[model samples]
Target: MRVQVVIIGSGPSGLLLGQLLGKAGIDTVILDRSSRAHILSRVRAGVLEEGTVHLADAAGVGARLKAEGLPHDGFSLAFDGRDHRIDLLDLTQGKRVMVYGQTELTRDLIEAREAESRLMIYEATNVMPQGFDSGTPHVTYEKDGVTHRIDCDFIAGCDGFHGASRKAVPDDAIRTFEKVYPFGWLGILAEVPPVDHELIYANHPRGFALCSMRSLTRSRYYIQCALDEQIEAWSDDRFWDELRRRLPAHHAEAMVTGPSFEKSIAPLRSFVAEPMRFGRLFLVGDAAHIVPPTGAKGLNLAASDVHYLASGLIEHYEDRSNAGIDGYSHKALARVWKAVRFSWWMTSMLHRFPGTGAFDQKIQEAELDYLTHSRAAETVLAENYVGLPY
Candidate 1:
């Protein structure tokens, strides 16, 4: 089979990229090693940056998002037994974030693509990109005991960190930088309403806690815990009690507790692979970089990467120009590093690191205090939180 582009991975990045390119008259075939059910089952980020919202619209899947997604003008930062509101809209001059779950957005994209009969090969094993650097690129994979090949003008490595695409690059060609945090976030999804309308991020003596919601009726909460903490050790009551101790008295009092439908522990890490473009194979999203979820930059960074990749591909196909493609890596990495820095800073400020000395604690306290009282520091948080311009 022959197509203009071949996309690996059916996550939000691959789906979103294919949606944009398909609308531009560029034929794309999506290949994923996992079943659609398995892909949809995973719970991921719920916050959407302004850029992601527009990208969803461009992908023709924002109607339900705009209807159901909550728009938060601001969120609160709880520290020193109190709450400090960061005015996202006011600080960013009307820019706000949309609270739309990634799973729902993926479902919308899948429906849109299926409606148009886009070719998506699921559960395809041994997927590989070939000849990405020799001016001719193609992808091959195995499906149902048959091997298939797709000739394409370009390859999009949207498959995540462990996917075959990034690994296709030689070690010498890609430079990697990574920092794994000492703690992980134990998150729970409950049917109860959130304690507050907007999200609350708390920095307490115990650890870091986040009060977030997927919608008005569905709440998502996370608390920092040791890397060794096991899921089986945490029950609904124990989790609630520990969460309440981390939050302010009022929020804790107003909190609604219920049986958690989903629970998992996610380790924190910041990783980036240099030069997102490996010849004709352009790495998008998790294939290229990962940021800690502290600033909600993981999916947002992926959205930005998709934006750059799609724009470059469209320019190449529509205008017969390589300018966008030629500059893809430099431009994408420029923004990616900024986000990595922001997420790292936020994680450091909010979490209680292992063996953090008294001096380090005092420094963290000073930073939080300054951030709460100083307009300049608040604007920095607001700008990064709402997202940097695409």
Candidate 2:
């Protein structure tokens, strides 16, 4: 088979890229090792920046998001037994975030693609990108014991951290930077109302906790844990108790407890791969960068990557220019680094290090205090949280 572009992932980044390209009359074939059900079943971050919302709308997948996504103008930063609300709308001049699950967004994109009769190959084995660095790039994979090859003009590696896209690049050609946090986030999803209308990020004496939601009736909560913490060790009741202990008295008192339907422990890390473009192959989303969930930048970063890559590809085809493609890596990396710094800052401020001394605790407290009282500091946080321009 031959197409203009072959996308090696069905995640939000890949799907969104395909959607944008399709709208521009460019043909793309998406390939993934996982089944459609598995892709949709994976739980991911829910926060959406304004730029991401606009991209979704442009992709024609925002109808459901517009009707159902929760719009939050501010979120609470709870510390020292009280809540300090950072008015995101006011601080960022009326910009806000949308609370829509990544799973739903993927489904929306997939459905839209299917409606347009686009090609998507799922559950393909040994999917690999071949000759991306040479002229006439193509992809190869095995499906149902049959090997297949696809010739394409370009390849997009959106298959995430463990996928074959980055691995295909020569070690000497790509540079990577990574920082793994000493802790992980033990999170749970329950069918219960959220503790507050807006999200709450708490820095407690015990640990860091976050109260987020997927919708009005579904709550997503997290608390910092040791890197070696086991999911099997946490029960619903125990998880609730520990979470309550980490929040202010008011939130704890009003919190509703229930049996959790989904639970897991995810290690926190910030990772980036330099020179996102390798010849005809471009790394997008997790394939290029990763951020800690503290700042809610993970999915938004992926969307921004898609934005840059899609714009470049559209320009390459429509205007017959390679300028946008040539500048993709530099432009995307600039925004990527700023978010990395913000996520690192948020993680450092909120999380408790394993061997910190009394001075460290005091510094963290002083930093939070300053952030709450100083409008200048609040504006910085608000701007980064809502996402920088694409």
Candidate 3:
């Protein structure tokens, strides 16, 4: 079908963009392979930055978020066997982040979109990108085993990192920047109550273990591990033992254990694809870049990317200004690279190398000490964590 914009992938980026544009009276269509809409909740990214919350509110989609989300002024840094709480309100006055899961945001947007008549789609369909510069930008796929071709004025490739959008780019014009670590993180979801009110990032000889809770009753936590580490390697009993040993601020802190609901592993890597656009097709979210989970920049950055894109596309359509839309690729790269650097720094300083020498270990400890002792260092971390709008 032909439309002003044909957005591929119904995840956060595409759905949010479509919602924003549709509210503006801009016609857009969203196509995905899933037959049913799904919420992205019950996963990762417990920390939400200040800027992201504002953007959601601006789009008129923050009602559920504001009601259900928790407000946290700051987080704690654990080092030297002690807890140092950096009150974010004290650091960045008045700007607060809400603690809401990515899945919750998706569910809100999904419900909102279900009431819209303009956005159309076929879930559980196979889609591919082609024939963009040749007049009609097309997404070819099969729905219910019947072949179909979707034509549009422009294509939003929100299919994510593994989708076919990246490969559609001319190899000569693409620049791939990558930094892979020697480790990965094993994230855990437990029905147990949270160990702390705020999230904690602990740097120890063992690895960088993060202490985070989803709600008063549900908790989410992560521990650093080897690249080759298997889920079976750490049984449920062993997981709790290591968590208690590494995350406690002191002997007084109590970690009420609960049954784990889910667990999974994510390989640590920093990646970005250059030019994010090729003719009429543009990429967003994981389709364009990937970041380590250390800084909690994954979902926030994707939201930022699509926010810019939706505005740019509006400019292009309403005012006949292709420059704003054309410059989207370049504009998005600025924030992407900055987050890449911040995420890499957090990852490098916390995770342990396979053959970490004594000097390296000492340096890591020293860096942690400086982060806690130095006010400027603390401010930098707070600013990055609270998130600055790019």
Candidate 4:
């Protein structure tokens, strides 16, 4: 295979990058080791910040999104049986988020690519990126016991946290910053309407409960638990009982109980590797950084990276300037750090303390109370939650 850009992984980042590049007349090829198109259909993130919505439209993949995505002006924060709404649109001057799943977004991008000439390689192997200055980078992969090499002008590593691309970088050049939280999210996908008009993030002695959604008929929810929690230990009845205690509403049991499609422990962590570019290869999305899911910033962050990547690549092509490539790392990190802080804040405020004195929980509640009651405090939360300018 020969192309201008070779993107690894067909997840949101890789697929979206491919769509953007393809629309730009850049011959891009996406290679994924997974043999089948993703149909997991489980809901993940529903909140989209204003800046992200604008960028998504500019990238050309936002056409169907604007039409089908459910728009929300704000979301609510709940604690002590009280619900407080943070009006994002009012705070951000017309900025609003959408309720959509990462999976559907991925599917949209892939469907858009159908008319384009990009290659989608599955059951791929070998998968090593080689050569740079020679003007052609090598991507070796094997399929059905047959080995093949893909040549491209630049390679994009978007496979994500566990992919092989990160390891391909020379050890001497990689500088990593990471934080592994003591807790993990026990996420569940249930067939039920949302518990509230807006998403509710609740703090309880049991743990943190996020009231999120996939659409009008399905709910995407999560509760905090020890990182080592096992799914086998949580029976269906036990799951409903826990949810009832965490979520506050009439018929709380009905709000939680329904046909569930997924229940898994998603580890919460924040990580970033410096200098996202090496030779002719660029790492975007999860290959470059990861944030805890509390802020619903994962897909947004991934999209932002590609937005800059697309911009940088365009500038480099139009002006014959290395400015885009040179500043890529610096520009990407500014956004990364802001997201990490927001995720950390939400995580700490909602989850239970392991051994902290009562003073700590009281302090958290105080902080929460201030944010919910004070316009200035909500302005801060609204700014971060609605997104940090991109």
Candidate 5:
């Protein structure tokens, strides 16, 4: 098979890029190692940056999001036994984020692509991009014991961190910067109303906790845990107890507890791969960078990456200009670094380090205090949370 672009992932980035390009009359194909059912079953964060919402609209999958996604103008930060609200809409000049799950967003993209009859190969095994440095690039994969090849002008590596895309690049060419946090987030999804209308990020003496929601009735909550902690060690009652202890009194009193339908521990890390491009192969989303969930920048950053990649591809096909294509890495990396910094900063401020001294704790408390009182600090949080512009 031959196409203009071969996207080696069916996640949001690849699917959204394909949808955008396909709408622009660009022929693209997506290949994924997972089945459609498996992809849809994966639970992930939903906080959508303003720029991401616009991109979803551009991809023709924003109707359901607009109808069902909750819009938040502000969120609260809990410290010193109180909740302090940051008015994001006011601080960011009316910019706000949408709470929409990644799973639902991927499902929407899948439906839109299928409706338009775009080709997508799921359960593609041993997918690899070859000859990306040459004028004629192609991808190879095996499916049902049969090997297949796709010839394309460009290859998009959206297959994520553990996928073949980034790994295909020679180690010498990749410069990586990473910091793994000492703690992980023990999270649970329950069928109950959220503690508040907007999310609450808590910096408690014991640990960090966050109260987020997928919908009005389905709440997602997380608390800091040791990196070595096991999900099997956390029962629903124990998890609820620890979460309540970390929250402010008022929020804790109002919180509802239920049997968790999903529970897991996600380790925090900040990672970025320099350049984000290797010849005809472009790295997008998790394939290039990862940020701690503290700032909720992972999926949003992926959307921005897709924005740059799609724009470059569109420019190459339309005006026959290589300018955007040539500059894709520099443009995407510039924005990726900023998001990575913000995520790292937020994680540092909120979570307790394993060996934190009294001095360090005092400094963390002081920073939170300043953030609550200073409009400037709040504005920075609001602007980054809503997104830094694509």
Candidate 6:
């Protein structure tokens, strides 16, 4: 099969990219190793920057989100047994984030793609991009014991970090930077209402905790844990108790506890691969960069990547201009690095290090103190939390 673009991965980045390009009269085939069900089943971060919501609207899948997604104006930073609110809407001149699950967003994009009868190959085995560096690029995979190939004018490596797109590049041709955090987050999802209308990020002597939600009735909570901690060791009761210990007294007292339907431990890390563009192949989302979830930048960053790549591709086809495509990496990476710094800073400020000295602890306290007392510092937090401009 031949098409204008071959997108490897049906995640939000690939699906959104395909959706935008298809609307522009560019044909794209999306390939993924996981079934549609598996992709939807995976739980991910729910925070959506304003720009991401706009991108969803542009992709024509924002109807449900518009009706159902919760819009938050501010969030609490809990420390020293108190709540310090960061007014995102006030600080950002009326910008706020949408609290909609990534799963739902992906489902919306998939349904839209299916409604348009766009080609998507799921549960394909051994999917790999071939000859992406050359003028003619194609992708290969095996489906139902039959090997197939897709020839395309451009290959989008949205297949994520573990996928074959980035691996297809010669090691010498690519440079990678990574820092795996010493701790991970133990999280749970329950059919209980959140403690507050807005999200709360808490810093405690025990560890770091985040109180987030998928909806008014569905709460998602996470607490910092050792990287080697086992998920099996945490029961619903224990998880709730530990989470309570990390938050302010008022929030802890008002919190609702219930039987959790989902539980897992995820290690935190910051990773980036240089350039983002490898000749005819363009890396998007997790394939090119990853940030610690403390700043809620993962999915939003992916959406921004789609914005750049889609604009570039559309410009190439419509205006016959290579400028956008040529500058894709440089432009995407500029925003990517800023987000990386913000996520790292958030993680450092909130999380407790294993063996830090007294000076380090004091500095963290001072930083949080300054952040809450200073409007300028709070604005910086609010601005990044809501998102930087595309």
Error of 3 at 113 (Å): 0.4
Expressed as tens digits, the lDDT of each residue in 1-390 for candidate 6 is 999999999999999999999889999999999999999999999999999999999999999998999999999999888988899988999999999999999999999999999999999999888888788899989999999999999999898889888998899989999999999999999999999999999988899999999999999999999999999999899999999999999999999999999999999999999989989999999999999999999999999999999999999999999999999999999999999999999999999999977777778878999999999999999999999999
Kindly list the per-residue Cα lDDT of model 4 for residues 265-338, writing each as its tens digit.
Answer: 88888898888888888888889888888888888888888888877876776688878877877788899888
Report clash pairs, candidate 5.
none
Measured over all alpha carbons after superposition, the RMSD of each candidate to the real structure, in angstroms, is 0.8, 0.6, 1.7, 1.9, 0.7, 0.8
| Deviation of model 2 at 330, angstroms | 0.3
Q: Top lDDT: which candidate number?
A: 2
Write the candidate numbers in order of decreasing lDDT: 2, 1, 6, 5, 3, 4
Off by over 4 Å in 3: 37-42, 120-124, 249-253
TM-score of 2: 0.99
lDDT scores in order: 0.94, 0.95, 0.80, 0.79, 0.94, 0.94
lDDT of 3 by residue, 1-390 (tens): 667888888777788888888877778888876644343433657567776777677667889888878898888877658878977887776666688887778777777888766565756356788887677678887777788877788889888788777878878978998888888888888888778888888877888888887787888888888878899888777888887677655622687776688888889889999888788988898999999998889888888888788889888888989987888999898998888889989888877778998889889889888888888888887787788766
lDDT, model 5, position 74: 93
Residues 1-390 of candidate 2: C-alpha lDDT, one tens digit per residue: 999999999999999999999999999999999999999999999999999999999999999999999999999998888889999999999999999999999999999999999999999989889899899899999999999999999999999999999999999999999999999999999999999999999988788999999999999999999989989999999999999998999999999989999999999999999999999999999999999999999889889999998999999998999999999999999999999999999999998899877788779888999999999999999999999997
* Tens digit of per-residue lDDT, candidate 5, span 27-46: 99999999999999999999
lDDT of 1 by residue, 169-267 (tens): 999999999999999999999999999999999988789999999999999999999999999999999999999999999999999999999999999
Q: What is the TM-score of each candidate against the true structure?
A: 0.99, 0.99, 0.95, 0.94, 0.99, 0.99
Clashes of 6: 0
Per-candidate clashes, comma-separated = 0, 0, 9, 0, 0, 0
Q: What is the lDDT of candidate 3?
A: 0.80
How much is 296 displaced in model 5, in angstroms? 0.9
